[model samples]
Target: MITIEQYVGKWSENEDWTEVRQAYAAQLLIQVNKLLEAAKKAGIELKNNPNTDSLISGTQYGGFRPQSCPIGAAGSSHKQGQAVDIFDPQNKLDGWINDAILTQYGLYREHPDATIRWCHLSTRAPKSGRRTFLP
Candidate 1:
């Protein structure tokens, strides 16, 4: 699991964004931690896997993408620090579409389409309690 300090923007290029990201860390930490826990419970190891590592680790993803980062959907939960895109390096958990554990942890997958493969979950509260998948 990653610490709040790991949730930073491009500090080297934009100090302002770094400050913003840090200030928002407290609000985001719990969510990120819960997400990580869910991943672990689902048997997804997010360590040094080539496809599942962080950008700082020389991979496209892992967790905590800042608003300044030029990837993912614009105005995404990722930018708000409430979401993470998990790369299932070992194809574990048979995909997160039907995982009851995720719901038990109060995490929701952003995409409902199983073909997307990777687990994209968020801590953002939904508009209605009837649904857990985002549009």
Candidate 2:
């Protein structure tokens, strides 16, 4: 099992995203590590080393830009450094994984009804509680 520190170290070593070594990135790294552990326990193989194409770089703070939607514009979460679009290796299993598993780790899929099919997960929570795009 990889510790969060180790995961963060590996992530920092990625030349493509070296800027993510900041404090905020470290926090996200810890959260992702926890998720990875849970996923491993559930027999799921998450692709941590996704291709560059799978990632959508954001202009705000190197977070991720959401695909354009009728509800709003792109790059919203980018500003807050709180959103990411995960690319699933198996398209068929993506929806189920996003809905059933990721939510347990403080992630929520956004804009399911939109044309683009990307899983949006964030650590952000509202005053009320954790929000879900589905139901």
Candidate 3:
């Protein structure tokens, strides 16, 4: 099981987030840990947490951006404690692990082709299994 301390350790590395945001991020991490453990039990290897330095330096902003917006723009989910960008330099795997697999565990998001790709996972429970950029 992932502890709160481990979650905080991972969250605190991101310099872009303020103390208040970091607290929210830590809570999100806890949810992520539960999802990750579920994925692991099913024989999946989720990517490692992206380096915070890389995430902070790679983009000027962070959050949910509309599909029409340019790449690297901020998106709203980041501010609401429901999403995170998993940076994988090689692009070896789809930003999201198999949606089918994730769906079984109640996680969902959309992936678009852009300069920088990051896996966006949400902790929010939707009424139906659908992708909503604003949610």
Number of the top candidate by TM-score?
1
Give RMSD to native, each candidate.
4.3, 7.4, 6.8
Which runs of model 3 end up more than 4 angstroms from their true locations? 1-27, 34-75, 93-96, 112-115, 125-135
Write one digit per residue (lDDT tens) for candidate 3, span 1-135: 333333333434445455655566566666556666665676555454444343211242333223333553364555444555544454333433565656665565545354245555666545665642323
Candidate 1 per-residue lDDT over residues 1-135, each given as its tens digit: 555545452432444345555545455556556756766786666554454344123254335564556776766666665655555444353254354665666666654454153556566655664324646
**TM-score, each model?**
0.58, 0.49, 0.47
lDDT of 1 at 111: 48
Question: Of the candidates shown, which would achieve the greatest lDDT relative to the real structure?
Answer: 1
Better of 1 and 2 by TM-score: 1
Pitting candidate 2 against candidate 3, the one with the higher TM-score is: 2
Consecutive 10-residue window with the lowest summed lDDT within model 3: 55-64
lDDT of 2 by residue, 16-131 (tens): 33344344445654565576567557676554423342222222222432233233344354333355544444432243455456566665445455314344555655344544
Ranking by lDDT: 1, 3, 2
Instruction: Report the candidate with higher lDDT, 1 versus 2.
Output: 1
Candidate 2 runs further than 4 Å off: 1-22, 48-50, 53-75, 91-104, 111-117, 126-130
Q: What is the lDDT of candidate 1?
A: 0.53
Each candidate structure's count of clashing pairs = 0, 0, 5
lDDT of 2 at 20: 41
